[model samples]
Target: MVSIGEFGSKIKENISRVIVGKEKTIERVLAVLISGGHVLINDVPGVGKTMLARSLAISLGLEFNRLQCTPDLLPGDVTGISILNLKTNEFNFRKGPIFTQILLVDEINRTTPRTQSALLEAMAERQVTVDGRSFQMEKPFFVIATQNPVEFEGTFPLPEAQLDRFSISLTMGYPDEQSERKLLKGISDEHPITSLKPVSGQDELDSVLKQVKEVEIEDSVLQYIISIVNETRSHRDIQLGVSPRGSIALMETARALAGIRGRRFVIPDDVKETACDILSHRIIIKPEARLMRRTNRDVINEIVESLPIPINNEKT
Candidate 1:
């Protein structure tokens, strides 16, 4: 069996074939996915943000599906419809692309809130409900939803409820010159994604997620988690604070980070390192604050800087 670190390294290399030079983005995606959490890739078009989602799906030996969220798109379109099978004299449920292992929900904000709500249930419960019936999803289910950061026109902003459903939100900006040059030269009759293969099958992926749950953390880490969340609640730059669910995600992601590093225990660095990604998007900024030129990134940095570090890592 491949070690957890080797497992992460192998998967990173597999996706890098198509998504050149964004190792950090690739690693975060892997960490959140293996941690049994969802991701929101925030960036512009033509940046391989969508491609990264596709590459990860391909590398994991999972069924991949892409939903181009648009104004006319409806909840039924994403969750599929319950149609009557005349021959069988019954209504059989035909599942949508969301039923797959990796669902690349491209341009998610373009669709109306009604359409977006279709995913809230599945994303949170790992199941879909149609005709008042709930169906369990396959193992290793993940949602790598991507959105355009610059375009808000005609875009329906995701509700805080929907946004909170995601575990971590990140951006994949333009790669450096070296990676862009490599992308151009590598194209022949095949795209880089075409030749990609899974590093390990679904079974292996499952084992890694199971191990991530077992990663331990000390009491100091728990206190650190509380302090960070508390800061978000009292910070003057924001109106709303991180929700309880958001705090839970932070702890789970921290543990997963520790496991991926081949350590059985988590440290303050893990929480501190992933704090921005894990908690930034969950914050609700006031309109006045936005007018005053404060970004969530800025507030996150301030909160992180103000916190005192743990003197000694005490075990729980």
Candidate 2:
């Protein structure tokens, strides 16, 4: 069996073939995968958000499906609909793109709120209901949704309920000068994703996820997580704080990070490292804070920094 680090490294190396100079971003995405949670990639256009989702899906050997969300997209288009069959004279259910293992929702914000709400159930329960019948998704179901941060004309901002479903929200910023030059030179002829192969299979991925749940988290570290979450609720600049789900996400993501680092137990550093990614999107900033140009990330960082580090003997 391949070690967790070795397996993670293989996936990263495969993805890096197409995505350049975003190692941390890749790892955060992998952490969400291992934690069995969805991700929201919020960035400007042409920053390889779609490419990252595609590469991860290909590297994991999962069935990949892309949904180009637009204002005209409907709930039935994403969750599928039951149609009458002419041959048998009975209704037959056809699965939509949401049935795939790795679903990339491109420009998700472009869709209407009703269409966007269709994904909430699937993201939270891993199942969708059609015509009063619920269908469970296949194992290893993961959603990688991308939205353009700078565009709002035709986009509907995802409600807080929908945003909370995503375990982590990250930005794939513009590549550095050297990496950009390399990207321009490398993709001139053909895209590297065409040649990419699966580095790990479904069974191995299941094993990794199982192991992530078993990673030991100390009491002190647990309290540390709670402290940060509690701070968000009482903070004057914040209107809403992290929920119980957010705490669970933080713990699960920290465990996955520990597993990725080849550690049997989680440490304080893991919680600190993943705090922003897990909690940032779940928080709602105050209107006053927004007027002062305060961002959710900044509030999360302040809470993380103000908390004391838990003492643990585990070595990273």
TM-score: which candidate is best? 2
Which residue pairs collide, candidate 2? Answer: none
Per-candidate local distance difference test: 0.87, 0.91
Candidate 1 per-residue lDDT over residues 140-240, each given as its tens digit: 78999988989989999998999999999999888899988998998889887888887778888877887887787788788999999999998888889
Clashing pairs in 1: none
lDDT of 2: 0.91
lDDT score of residue 194 within candidate 2: 92
**Strongest candidate by lDDT:** 2
Writing each residue's lDDT as its tens digit, candidate 2 over 111-186 gives 9999999999999999999998999998888999999988889889999999999999999898999999888888
Off by over 4 Å in 1: 313-316
